[model samples]
Target: MSTIFRASRPAFRARTFFQQNASKTTRRFQSTESTTANAAPESWMQRFWKSEKGPKTVHFWAPMMKWGLVLVGVSDFARPAESLSLTQNAALTTTGIIWTRWCLIIKPKNYLLAAVNFFLGCVGVIQCSRIFMHHQAQKKLAEEVSEAKEAVKEAKDAIKHKSS
Candidate 1:
């Protein structure tokens, strides 16, 4: 029994040591000064990428738009139509523009990409404007149709009343 107790004493000491250090580790993490001292300074690019606006444009929008443009290009190539090609180009340009803006805003600005994006965005803007106008016209036509239907219903009601 004494031999077994002596053998277990080492394990008991190790457990106590770990328990004491665990609280210190937790406290070290909770203290800002200690954490900063231990952590390496973040690079400007890293800091920029971590920023709220940066992540949204860079991680989310940039990738989504890029993939969308790629798919559009592939579909256009398969079809080989003028309109489809134009649409693909417009979308590509818009994505480039957004990417350029994101690059410019972040650390290490990429002027070349920004210039390319700006030119493409400008070209695509024309296509986008035309699409916007068409959508507006459709909305106006729908409103007119609804108004006409309402008028027709009112006229029918009046006619029925007069007949009665």
Candidate 2:
């Protein structure tokens, strides 16, 4: 029993030492400097420049650069509708919608990112629509051409039968 108590005594001391140091570390995290109400009011531009998600960070610039995609998408409107790719537009639309929602839901809402993503979604949707329309017209035209070919063959067969 004496040996058992001696073995447990060291463990008990170690536990107490850990507890005391944990409390001290918690207290050590307390702020030493007090912020006074006498601080000068910052201008809107200054506030924007210093913001964590502002021009200094990728959150702002990345979205700014993304505007190029939107511009290109808009410009592509002039091209023949048949040139648009359905798969590429569909992928852009999916990613744009997902990223827009994510940027909005994040801790710091990135409105610029959301705007760019929203525009991308719009561009993708428009392009997809154009592509679908072009494909539909092509399908209808192909069917009509096949029908015309069959009609000509039947007419030729009728003429051949009459001659025979």
Candidate 3:
């Protein structure tokens, strides 16, 4: 039995990690096209967005991690102090479940800590996406602007030659 359990533990963890990573990769690839949908051809934004993998992973894993942290937060707040009976621990667990589900559902904002955490999680997702998009857009704009300047310089040189 011990051998069976020991052999299974690593397998289980590996399976879980792969499952999580697979989903994360799927989300990133799916979102990459949309992230630069507005980018112009040959623009730095297009090239930059085309090369990234971060946005997709965040798109996939942010929700899962938020929920995990919620559970952890609940556990920390509900754990009984020293000298507590087993019954107290059970009761606290039940209470924590109820509170967690409730905050997730009805009165979320009433629990300030949970609310803040939730908001931060959402903001983090949006910020990550926005930052990537912004960088892409900036790169595109810079490249376009530089190209335009070069074109203008060439046109001016052509005019000078014609006048000479």
Candidate 4:
């Protein structure tokens, strides 16, 4: 009886070991197959647009536009065209504001830069309005001057004809 028990114990251990290994292998295979089966196929457009390179290009161009507008605005400000400068400033400020909002969307917890951008945009708009008003006033003054000059020329021509 002791010899029979010893012989059967080894066989039992081997059987359990094989069963456990088989179960593990089966589970692993099933999980991989299920994941592959469940995954939806990506379209070419989706793959291209969502690729890492696409995001890199957007990030690069957005900042470049924002900074380029700023430089253009600064250089324009030095000239005498206040209205054009103000318009450029407004555009630059808006770009900065949009870029900051985009950054916030990408990283929601950061709000400091966004707030600054918003404030600057507001200031730019106000400045644009003021400059636009001044530009209009200047234009109106020039029109009036031109009309007065035309009236004076007509009066002079009338006097010359009467004297003849």
User: Which regions in candidate 4 have their CA more than 4 angstroms from the true location?
Assistant: 1-84
Candidate 3: tens digits of C-alpha lDDT, residues 1-164: 99988976776445676778887787654654575677655777555455432234443244455566445434443433322243443443454445445555653133433444554444334334444565678799999999999999999999999999
TM-score of candidate 3 against the unseen true structure: 0.30
| lDDT winner | 2
The TM-scores of all predictions, comma-separated, are: 0.37, 0.73, 0.30, 0.45
Q: What are the per-residue Cα lDDT tens digits for candidate 1 across 41-100?
A: 999989878865465465445544445444544444344232443565566666767777
Candidate 4, poorest ten consecutive residues by summed lDDT: 107-116
Evaluated at residue 51, the lDDT of candidate 3 is 41
Which pairs, if any, clash in model 2?
A: none
lDDT of 4 at 22: 88
| Candidate 1 colliding pairs | none
Give each prediction's root-mean-square deviation over alpha carbons: 15.1, 6.3, 30.6, 18.5
Window of ten residues with lowest summed lDDT in model 1: 76-85
Scored against the true structure, residue 142 in model 1 reaches a CA lDDT of: 100
Backbone Cα, N, C clashes tallied per candidate: 0, 0, 4, 0
Computed on alpha carbons, the lDDT of every model, listed in order, comes to 0.64, 0.89, 0.53, 0.64
